[model samples]
Target: MIKCIAIDDEFLALEIIENYVSKCPFLELAGTFSSPLEALPLLNECGCDLLLLDINMPEVNGMDFLSAIPNPPLVVLTTAYPQFALAGFEAGVVDYLVKPFSFERFLKAIQKAQSRLAPRPAGGTGYLFVRSAHRMIRVDLDDILMLEGKKDYVAVHTQTQVIDTLTTLTAFQDKLPVKDFVRVHRSFIVALNKINTIERNVIYMGDKKVPVGEMFREDLLRRIG
Candidate 1:
């Protein structure tokens, strides 16, 4: 369920939104506030996936409130004024619900927020980040030749360079997609796509040769088949 909070200066507007939220199975109303100022502390403490906000609230309007947050939650603006529709979208709102909106309209807004929060498409560009030394480094899975485990640390061997990361081979294995990479030995993992030759029990990536463990041989052959 998407955890959400509602904020409106009008008590009746808050009640209507709370009721609408209750009806949606995909939504969970974490809290409701008549004053946006009073809701700030609760919002920070409870956390939320989405914010149902009214634009014309006293003290601080919804647009200004959302702008103040560095990384605000997905917003669905609720107000009688259609004039602020363009402004709301500029502030990164998922959807704008003109007040006195139907339950169906509210549901559509929630669905829009859900789409934004959804995970990226699978096989995501075949790249990921790993921490090396004191910094995070981007490593392209397609460019990786092999991975070698040195106890608590693992070295990622790419086409042009070797990156020593502060993570184990097992941990790296779990992160890589099974279709493009495989764990062939206890201390070694190889990129199946980058394998140039397999001689006896050894796999070769350019000049680098990695021994394939006996236990992983059958699975490797099956995958390659």
Candidate 2:
């Protein structure tokens, strides 16, 4: 596995990278940090093979962070700004992914990392465990249709059952495969393959209609498209 560390001030961005890392069997998540300064210790340790560094951050910027390290690992810079792409490439980044990037795009970056680091092996299973009724329940990735968020719980909707898990939506979302599952709304996350169709801004899944949040509409569309 090509071990990797991610640094992003945005908690949501870190969450997205964490989820993406989970999907790639060849990529191992070594660590994640909210601040670039906090990551200096780990970077100095040289335990990772790749760095998913965000460009816009406090304490120190991505370019500065790159410059601080001697013999840095393969880097895939993530940012909202396109202007930094040239600088990132000039500074020797493996790839550059703009904000709200797709899993397919992330894979391209990983491909570059693998070319320089290690060859990818086989993949993993299609299931994950979730805490429900004080017990961990095994939910198959293929069985999951949608996830509905409650106050302090998540309704795990599968083809045969709807298991009520004791966890926040964001927490549950972290456990899912980033490529297949998407948080369309604050209260809902749906499997891309399970979506029957989309009418207007809502997603159609058999008898259910999931409302897409304005913030996540573009991402949802990109995933389905």
Candidate 3:
């Protein structure tokens, strides 16, 4: 089961999350907090698999709370504001749920979080075989520098060269190891080791500069720093 916690200042929101958790056999509700602050102690004391967080909160917001935590669990933003979606994504939130979301939408977001947190085999090389242009390509985790979106295709930037193929960013993103690679922009994903420096909204990989989206800036800073 995927252990999780729900943090929302509104009692009604918490109740809805609780009810949803009960219906999903794969999800185990560990706790529910009306205040993000109260949830911090439990998070520090015991590691959780998933966090359903709220963006707007008194004292500290979900984004700030996540920033304070050293190594946060997979987070799914639950907020009334849709504008915060990009910001939440940049903060490494596994998913985003606008308030008054249906159970179906909620389930989809949690499933994504679960996929991200799923356990990998010991000593695994973390390689993925992707079919590009009817040809199978084996990608090594360490060699990738970044990925960029080109229309409907994604350009896989590696240490040696760039490879372009028809694939959605999300499709390729799901195949990558969460710890080693990060989606720093809607159009880009960079390998952690390849990042030489971060200056404002740009990430430098050697001499190449990758633009960091506004919403992703905070998350990239946290990852690189």
Q: Could you give candidate 1's per-residue lDDT for residues 56-83 as a string of tens digits?
A: 9778988888866644676889999999
List, residue by residue over 16-97, the lDDT tens digit for candidate 2: 9999999999888989999888988888876588899998997899888787675567689999999998676545467889
Worst 10 residues of 1 by lDDT: 86-95
Listed in order, each prediction's TM-score against the native is 0.54, 0.52, 0.75
lDDT of 3 by residue, 37-118 (tens): 8998889898798999998998688888887777788888999999987666656677889989999999999878776776
On TM-score, the stronger of 2 and 3 is 3
Query: How accurate locally, in lDDT, is each candidate?
Result: 0.79, 0.81, 0.83
- Candidate of highest lDDT: 3
Q: Candidate order by TM-score, highest to lowest?
A: 3, 1, 2
Clashing pairs in 2: none
The regions of model 2 sitting more than 4 angstroms off are: 119-225
Model 1 TM-score, all chains together: 0.54
RMSD of each: 18.0, 13.5, 3.6
Steric overlap count per candidate: 0, 0, 0
